[model samples]
Target: MDFGFTDEQKILRQTFKKFCEKELTREYVAWMDENCDFIPDELYKKLADLGLFGMIIPEEYGGSGMTFTDYMIAMEELSTASVAAGICAGLAVSFGAKVIGGMGNEEQRRFHLPKMAAGETKYCLALTEPGGGTDIINAMKTTAVKKGDNYVLNGQKVFISGGNVADYMLVVALTDPKAAKRTKAMSVFVVDAKTPGITVNLIKKVCIHACGTTEIFFEDVVVPAENMLGVENNGWNKLVDVLNPERIGTAMLSLGIAKAAYQAAHEYSLERYAFGKPIGSFMVLQHYLADMLIEIENATNLIYKCCYLMENGLPYHMEAAMAKIVAGRASEIAAIKGMEILGGYGVCMEYDLQRHFRDYKQMVFSPISDEMAKNMIAQWTGLPKSY
Candidate 1:
C-alpha cells in the first residue's frame, strides 16, 4: 500500500536525474542519434563507474544488490533525458549481469560478474531469430550440438541490441530437438564474441540509433561446456527471470520517454504565444496536455507497482504485461501529442521532441508487442488462446 520511496531510493532517483541532466542533454543525445550506432566506450565506462551497471547484480558478486524498484527509478530518470541511455543501461544490468547472477554458477559469477560490474565486459542477449521474434520457443531453430570438448552452435539471432560490441553474448539454442516440446530442450550459453564463425551484421533502425541493433550468425561457433548457464535442457524456465525484468525495464523506459515529451511540450506551450495568448491557455491544447499527464501518471503507477511486486518476490507475470501494454500506449500518445503541439518544429531533426517520438515507438513492439502483451493477459485470465 505504500506509495512513497525510501530515503535510499530517493537518493537513487536524484543521483540518476542529476547525472542525466548533466550528461544526456538534448543536444548531446541528438548528436549521438545522428552519428553513432552505439554508446561510446568512454561514456559506457563512466556509467559503469556510477554504479548503474551493478544495481541488479548481487553483492556477493561485486554488485550493489539493489531492489528492482531502484532499478526502475534509475530507468525512469535516465530515460527522461534519453531513452537510448535508459535502454543501454537496462541491457547491461537486466539482461547481461542478471544472466550470470541469476542463472550462472559460482565460477561463472566469480569470473564474469565483477568484470560486468566494472564495465570491463559488455553483454548482449541473443534470443530472437529470423522467424522466432514472438513465438520464440516454438519457432526456435538454433541448435547446439555436443562435441568432443565443446558445444558447436549453428543458428541465427535477430534484433539483438549491442550485439556488435558485446564482450560476451548469452545465446539460446536447442540442445534436444527431438524432445516432445521445444520448451523442454532449450539451453543458454555465454559465448565469447570473438569465437570463430560468429558474425554480427548491423541492422539499420530509425529509432534509438545510439543503442545499436543487429542480427548475429553462428556457424560452428564452438563454446566450452563450462560456459553453459543453468542446467542443460532447462533454459526455458530460467529465461523467464531475464524476460520479466526486461518487460518492467521497458515499461520504465516508456514512462521516461512520456515524461520527456510531455515536459518539452509543456514548456513550449507556456512560452509560445498565439492569438494574443499562450497556446497553453487554449482549452483544446490544455485538454491534450491534461490527458497526456493523466496517461503518464497511470502508466507510472502501474510500472512502480510491477517494481514492488518484483521486489517482494511475488508473481508479476500479469502485472508486467499490463504495465507494458499501458506504458507503451501512454508513451506513444505523449510523443504524438508533443509532435502535434510542436507543429512544424516537431518533425525537424533540430528539436528533441521528434527524437522522443521516434525512439518511443520501439517500445510498442519490443520486449513484446502491445498486442502480444494483451494476448498474454488474455491467457493469464483463462481466456482461450486467440493465436
Candidate 2:
C-alpha cells in the first residue's frame, strides 16, 4: 500500500491549509467564540464552494467524491484553524451525507444527498439521550411505533450537534421490543425539523461553542415510514457502520486540536524570553516540544491508517477505535502541556490554546469515550472487556 498522499491529495491539503490561514484565522475564530453564535452562513457557503461539505459523497449525488484520506486531511486543517469549524464540517461531510449515501434507498439518496451536498440541508445524528450516554446500544430508550405509513416517535435526544439548526435529523429508536439482543430491533428514521411534535432546545455547552448542540424532545413526532433507513429493525448494524467512520473523523478532531495547541506553545516558547534567552532554547522546553511532536505524528499516522481502512472497505472497527483512543489521549496531553508552557495565559480564552484545550476535552467524551474504545479493543483481542 502506498504510504504517501497522491499529488492531487497533496494539492487539496495545501488548498485547505491556505483557506484556513486566510479565512479561518484566529481573529475570526475569536469573534465567534466571543459572540457564541453558529458559523456564518457565508463561511458555510465558502466551504461548500471548496467542496468541503460533500468531500465524501459521489458525484452523482452532487459531491466531489473524494477519498476518506482527503476528508481526514481537510478535517485536520479545518480543526487547525478552528476546532468548532472542524467539528461542523467533519459531521456534515463524513456522517450527514453518508447516512443517505450508504443506507438510504435510491429515491432517498436522489432526494437528500444533493441538497446535503449543496449545503442546503445540514444533517445531525440524533442517537444520544440524557440517560443513554455511552450505553447507546442496548440502553437506548427511544421508541418508534408503526402508524399506518408513518412512524410515531417518542423520545428525547441530548448533546446533539446541529440539533437546533439542522434541516433534518437522523434519529435512532427501538422498533421491535422482542427482537434478540444485538440484532434487528433498532431502527433509524429521518425526521424533518419542522415536524409538529418535535421540540429543540439549545443546550449551553462549555466548548466547541461555534457548533450548535441541543436537546430534542420527540413527542409522537410523525416520520414517514418511507423515511426509515435500511430495514425497519436492522438499525443496530447501520448505526455501527455509520459510527466507525464517525470515530475516524473524531480522531481527526483530536489530531487537529493537538497540532493547533502545539503550534501555539511552540510559537510562544520562541518569542517569550526567560533568563536572557528564548524559552525554547532551554533543554527542558525542547524535550517537551519534541515529545508533543512525536505524539502528534504517531496519533496522526494511526488516524490516516483507520481512514484508509474505512475507504478501502477493510475490516477496521478495532483499528478505528484504537485510533480514536490514541488521538484523544494524545490531544488532551498535548493541550495540557501547551497550557503548562503558556503558564497563566494558557487558560485565558483570548488565546487559542485554551479553546483547543476545552474542545479537545469535549472530543474525548464524544462519539465514543476512551474507556469505551479500550473496551472495544479488548473485545477485539478476544479478552474480557470492561470499561
Which segments of model 2 are wrong by more than 4 Å?
385-387
In model 1, the worst 10-residue window by lDDT is: 240-249
Residue pairs whose backbone atoms clash in candidate 2: none
TM-score of each: 0.98, 0.97
Question: lDDT of all the models against the reference?
Answer: 0.89, 0.85
lDDT per residue as tens, model 2, 1-387: 778998898998999999999998789998887775468788888888888888788999888888888888888889878888887776677667877678889999999888878877888889898886788776778899998998999989999997877888999999997787745789988889899999999988778889889999999898999999999899879768766688888888888888888999999999899899998998988888888898898888899888777767788888888888888877887898898888888988778888877788788878877887788788889887664
**Candidate 2 lowest-lDDT run of ten:** 90-99
Model 1 TM-score, all chains together: 0.98
Tens-place lDDT per residue, model 1, 22-64, is: 8887788888899888887888888898898988788888889
Let me know the TM-score candidate 2 reaches against the reference structure: 0.97
Question: TM-score: which candidate is best?
Answer: 1
Residue 24, candidate 1: Cα error in Å is: 1.3
